[model samples]
Target: MGLITPIGFFSIVQKPSDRTHDTLTVRARMRGDLAALK
Candidate 1:
C-alpha cells in the first residue's frame, strides 16, 4: 500500500510534466514560424 501510493503520486506528477514539455515544444515551434513570417 505504501509503495503504491508513492508510485501513483509519481505518475500524476509525471503526466503534467510531460504535457507541459509538449506544450513548450509546440509553442517554441510556433514562435519560430511566426518570426520567420515577419
Candidate 2:
C-alpha cells in the first residue's frame, strides 16, 4: 500500500492523461490486428 501510493502520485504528476491514451491506443491496435487476422 505504501509503495503504490508513491507510484500513483508520480503518475498523476508526470502525465495524468498518459494511461488513458495508452489504453485507447492499445485497444485500437488490438482491433486492427484482429481484423487483419480475420
Candidate 3:
C-alpha cells in the first residue's frame, strides 16, 4: 500500500513471506509536489 503527503510518501508491507522467513517491514520515501495527481 502507498500514501502521498505534501513533501513525501509512505509505504508499508505486512506479513511478507519468503521461502524460509516471514518479515514485517515499514518503508518511507520523499517526493516532489504531485500537483497533477491532486
Candidate 4:
C-alpha cells in the first residue's frame, strides 16, 4: 500500500502536464499544416 501510494500520486501529478504537452504539440502541428496549405 505504501509503495502504491507514491506511484498513484506521481501519475496524478504527471498526467495533466503530459496532456498539456500533447495538446500543444498537436496544435502546433495543425497550425503548420494550415500554413502550408495556404
The TM-score leader among the candidates is 3
Better of 3 and 4 by TM-score: 3
Question: All predictions: root-mean-square deviation over Cα?
Answer: 16.1, 12.8, 8.1, 15.6
Please report, in order, the local distance difference test score of every candidate based on alpha carbons.
Answer: 0.33, 0.33, 0.54, 0.34
lDDT string for model 1 (1-38, tens) is 11233213111133466776664222223344435434
Which regions of candidate 3 deviate over 4 angstroms?
A: 17-24, 30-38
The 10-residue segment with the lowest total lDDT in model 1: 1-10
> Residue 37 error for model 3, in Å?
21
lDDT of 3 by residue, 1-38 (tens): 88775655766576536324666544565333333234
Residue 20 CA displacement from its true place in model 3, Å: 14
- Ranked by lDDT from best down, the candidates are 3, 4, 1, 2
lDDT of 4: 0.34
Error of 4 at 5 (Å): 46
Q: What is the Cα-based TM-score of model 4?
A: 0.23
Error of 1 at 34 (Å): 0.4
Candidate 4: give the clashing pairs. none
Candidate closer to the true structure by lDDT (higher is better), 2 or 3: 3
